[model samples]
Target: MNAVLRRHAGYYLPFLALAAVLAVFPLVASTNMVNIGVFALIYGIAAIGLSLLMGLAGQVSLGQAAFFAVGAYTHAILVTRYDVHGLVAAVTAVLAAMLVALLVGLPLLRLRGHFLALATLGLGIIVSVTVRELEYTGGTSGIFGIPKPEFGGRVYDSPREFFWLLVPFVVVGLLMARNLVGSRTGRALSAVNDSEVAAECLGVNTFLLRLKVFVLSAGYAGLAGVFYAYWLAVVSPEAAGFLLSVHFLLMVVLGGLGTVWGAITGAVVVEGLDEGMKALIPRIVPGATGEVQLIAFGVALVLVVILLPGGLAQLWEMAVSRLRRRGSAREPGELPTVAVREGPRDDVPGTGEVSLADLLAEADVPERGTVVLSVRGLTKRYGGVVAVDDVDLDVRAGEILALIGPNGAGKTTCFNMISGVLEPTAGTIEVLGSRVEGRAPHTVADLGATRTFQNLQVFGSSTVLGNVKVARHLRSRSGVVRGMLGLAAREEKEIERSAMASIAALGLAQDADRSVTDLPFGRQRQVEVARALALAPRLLLLDEPMAGLSGAERDELAELLRRARDAGVAVVLVEHDVDAVMALADRVAVLDDGRLIALGTPAEVRNDPAVVAAYLGTDDEADDIVRHAAQEVR
Candidate 1:
């Protein structure tokens, strides 16, 4: 409990203090100011939704106002025409809008960049036009006389009462927003935004996650729509149009893209400034408020984006951090690096060279020779060009199989086909007898064979622990809904612990929280391998895992591969380092011109005439082969 409190105290304490201020502000402020605050809070709820979709998910939505309109129309038509209670109508309205969002978002979410933005913008236009043409929607004018919430024969008719009611929407919305952005799914969203390939290989279903956030953001807009209806007692076509969507987008940008406080800050600042300017400008210089308000908004947004691109939330966080640091400062720290945590390493004296024999004793490991991955006639093509033609391979439960050849030998292509990174042109790929040839990369990962990239695919935006924890997606079943509600706390903690253990086991304990991007090239390569291992794959496909390591590091990798095989994980490596391959692999396959030129135990294949001619070649080519083989890990 203390750990939890200590971790979240920075967030909770300030929130409570702000809540106290908000709770009493209406009582002390003038009626007009109180009314402005209510509108700002309502706008804030929608802004938070936009922030999540755009800032975190890397989606651009321009249909927020349409969702808001859908909510308003649902409530207006239901409550005014059907005599439904206001709160029930509000709930129905939000649900109706979400339903619309669900139907629309399915197709829109698939489009990328400005394509998605334009599609969403089109949705807003369609909603506005449809509402304008419909009689039930009040055509041109919107449905009016929406009822206020009533309980015990008293309506919440006053601005103060409505303010109190809307306050919870803002508070609850922000809390939920914060909750989601900090959860496991939240990290997946960031991972998706940062690198979709990296996230998918870690087993994140990017398309599904994007669709979920899209609908949730729509629901938020819907809630705000219902609030607008109740507060104004009217719903108009203008409420569902382009300008309002632009305003919401402006709020998202002017504050900060993905921040909880920025969402509210943006909404409050934009709405308050516009309304305040309209009131003050007309009195000072009659009938020029709209133009002046636009000018102010343009200038303020430009400055915010140019100066503090993180928005007002970032500025606020910086100020708070500075004030807190003055009272309790620590020495300036260096970027993190991984070191082994003291345990068996300390007890065993001298580096207890972790070997295959020690790892073979682990309880979970299968016996030395179980079937893990089997590929039959695996072929891949690019148009008329055959990349990996009719290759057959097997990786047993406790053995390393190295696929090696010259640069254009299709070694990487064969690995890609097996890992589901590339769909095979013809033939079958399976893990333990289950076919995975046509499946997605994520599906293959979930099926227990995850691959690392030839180039590093670490989540550069996330911490080292975060990168590995994402690969543990299959290990935890607690999902987006449970995570947001904080119901998955126990399971999530276990997942974190497991990720940490994997990091520690890899001798990365000291750098468990470090950014992968901040690490050296060699360390980044290790992080890539560590992330693949963290998936707990039954078959691990490593594309040059020893790429940039030193000689000692390469030896460490050779031992690591042996250790992995001993632990009952099948290992498939595509490597250029011939010496390491010969040392590590139980069997070797050589490819040339997309054909298997040689396949046998290392000694058998090494002496094959086909391998010598195709791979080792003439004196100059053999010299090239020798140079490639001796290319040091680093």
Candidate 2:
């Protein structure tokens, strides 16, 4: 009860204060103050969209103002020139804005960071200039006398009347933003924002997810624009101006980039600042009132960025976490013990004392012997350097192949070429028998192939189970709309259950809810494998998976690989632990200087003079007998 009060205190207090304030301001405030409230509410709606795009998807779009302008003009033109009803015009404006967003986003969302920002800035400039020059859009003079929306024969022509009209939409918009961010779309966006390459390797189509967020954000801006048009009864080029775009961007950053409520809060703060600065600037510097307000906004933004870079929502999160820790923490050495439950398990025929093939027969793992992955003539080059050259490898179902080499032997480079991370200079990669040499990483993953990174890509901000669950993206069918509407609950529950099963298989069930970042390096590696395993791919590529594991952990992982292989999944093992590789791999391939040097059974590779001399080195104990014999014969 106490924790609930503490947690919701901040939430409820702000909501009630804002509601009470907005609810009463129109009743008692002057007309100018009421207009300011209207502006704040309207812009708050736009900021929510920005939050989803910039905050959630890690996309920085600066031309949301263009969307706003497009929407306002769409409604204004439709109603005045075409004899359309206000409701129809409003709906048309929203759909048009969405269409424009879709067209722009498909191309622009691919550009990252400032490049995207600049592209959108240019878009806003273009729209603003075009609107001002077009006679049909009313040129520099703008369009006026836009009709007021009439509902039940009531016309909201006055600011006070419009306030009542717009408040409901503002509420609905906030609710939708919350719902959208909590759904699968939000999950994919979060994964993409963390690392696009890593997310794609896990089967997330980064382009598609980012584009969806972009279009949705634009729709919000457009919706807000429609309302602005109706309220002012006019539309102007200034609505789509570069400065307005900058202003909207600043609000999203100022409040909190990733937080929905932060966007709304940021908008209110910006509007209040605008009004306050205007009123005070005249007294402080009458000669430059309007220009000084811009300066003041710049100064405020700089200070907030310098002092509170995470924005207000992050600040609130940090404070809440601290409070919760204090409230819920037990004294040191006085913690209660958690009881461990035990259940019966019927062992497979060969789990403890038989070969993996026997275990496969007993455990009923898949038995399809189809070739899962086939790589032929794979090669990659960088300028004058050859990274992987003419490499041909075949990975079939139900076997583990260890790729071993000394440092800088291009083992990872070969893996990259096959996994779609690097475009091969000349090669072909076929997964399930279709060429995918130059396909995107996500595309490769879609064809039943996925890989783990050597450096561990854990999405650290999420839970261990969360990390595993996100990897199930390709397996689950519940999408953005279904998730946001809460219709994907069954799929969500199934996903979590599957994640837990994966974790349990890897002996990580104890850390399911733990933040992966809090785990030790060894545990983190386990989580990475768990996430990969969740993909349920026919081919699994593991890079240095045993790098940080202890002797016992390595043995456990070896058994896990056996189970994976027995279940009809092909496993690619890249490791420095020769013993693990010899025990786990059915075949061994060695690379040296971007070329395959040895390919055979582990015993054959160990005994091959070329492999021993090139990889094991002249001083290696594996070649001691040959070296000694040669010296004696000499």
Candidate 3:
């Protein structure tokens, strides 16, 4: 109930208020104000498109104007030269623009950050130049005699009547955009934006998702372009130039990056400022109209970037929260929730739902097994250096197996072979009674296997819920189109319930809506674990789960891991923290120079002479100790 109210309260309430204002606006405001509203609506459409691109897809597109122009020109040609209907031409124009965006974004979207920005910028410049040079576009003069739509056999003759006509389309467009951005596909775009690597690991096709968002963004720009051409009865190169594209980007940034209403707010505020300054400049500075306006606009943008990086939406949100707090104050004797707390529960079971025995039985892995993950005579060499040399190891089920060595011990290389990140040159890898060698990482993951990276791999820009949701996608039975259309899947509600349950299990319900960036390092680590758990794998490989954690945080994580093990999940933990390995691991494997020198219970491995000697020696000297120990054991 609270969620429903929160959803409707923010922009929906404002939208309702705006409807009232728009209804009475024509009667109260001047003709100029009405004109401004129409213009703002059109600009809002473009802003919405750019927001989906730059904000949602995490692509920096400085070429929105190019797509915008394609739409406008396509409509102009279809309606005038080809004698097509305005409505049909408009739809065709949008499709044409989307095709163009897809074709261009396919290759260009592969580039990261500024590379994408610059590439799109180049595309915009090419478009602007082409339009200016082409005879069909009327060069610098542009195309004229663009036909306006005649609806119900009556032409829209006046600007006021035209405003009413455009307003509905604008509203419809906004609704569609809202729906697109609010759905699962929309969240996927955000996931890619946040972290492409992590998204891919979660079974998201990042490239395809990028293309999808590019097409959607371009489609919106295309629709807006058609509206602009019909409203002005002109199509020009200047209308979709690089500067115009920048203007759209600035609008989204000034409004808010991720919020939908921010686009409209940004468009209205910035465009109104532009118009107001144009009017005031001539009166105040005489002939310095252009120069003065640019100076003022630049300064305003800098101020916004510095003071309101979250933009107007965040500012408004903060204001409303403050207002609510002020409206109701606590009595002097009333204690805060923070001041009251229940004691810990001794009855609550640990993290996993099943016992270790069950997990081993399900995977057909023995409690004291033969090799579950074995590498024999494994060697990976680059040029003259051998990264992993004739390494042999075994990982048993139902044990916390620790793989630890110095930075260049090829510990990662060994893991790469086991998880199928790299091919072993001279060995076989048998996982779960199959010769699962040289498969892709995803293929490895699909075979009851899941692994985390050594480096932090949380989707930083996405909310805690968003990150976990991506994890659940691997298990989601719904297809892409179903999610986009907001259709009820076979188990849509069930999937949602399951995702929430996973979040709750991680004790992250309080931080569910908060972005990973907002959380501390320890919480982000927990988020990663939550994601892995969502995969529902039998063999869970954790790479340094406690890296960069505080002592207290590490202790808590250790307890969490113990609970997970207790719940029938087999875990493989790789860490350099000897104390943590000793405390949490049922059995430990010590890796030096890519070969396992010692593998036994924590007490046995800790007491191993070779294990002690390897730690005592320098990083380089450890490899010799591993070799000697392996020979001695054999």
Question: Using alpha carbons, what is the TM-score of model 2?
Answer: 0.90
What is candidate 1's lDDT per residue for 139-221, written digit by digit as tens? 99888887787766777789998888777667767877888887888888888887787788778888888898888898999
Model 3 agreement with the true structure over 9-99: per-residue lDDT tens digits: 7745755666666666767777887788778888788888888777777888999999999999999989989899888999999999999
Per-residue CA lDDT of candidate 2, range 1-634, in tens? 5654675476447555656666777899889888988998899888899999987898888898999999999999999889899899999999898899999888887788899999999889989999999999999978898988899889898889988788778766776677677677787778777767778988898888888788888889999999999988899999999888888888889898878889888888889888888787777887775778878867877888888888877788899999988887888888644322122122223323222233224223235566777888888889999888788888878989999988888888877877888889997889888788888999988877788888778786677877888887887887767765667755665566566667777788777777789899999999889888877777889999999999999989988898888788889989887767766788889988888888887767777787877877666575664444334323
CA RMSD per model (angstroms):
4.9, 5.9, 6.4
Q: Kindly report which residue stretches of model 1 are placed more than 4 angstroms away from their true locations once superposed.
A: 151-154, 279-289, 317-368, 617-634
TM-score of every model versus the real structure? 0.90, 0.90, 0.80
In candidate 3, how many clashes are counted? 3
Ranking by lDDT: 2, 1, 3
Candidate no. 3 TM-score? 0.80
lDDT value, residue 259 of candidate 2: 84
Which parts of model 2 are misplaced by more than 4 Å?
A: 1-31, 284-288, 334-368, 618-634
Tell me the TM-score of model 1. Answer: 0.90
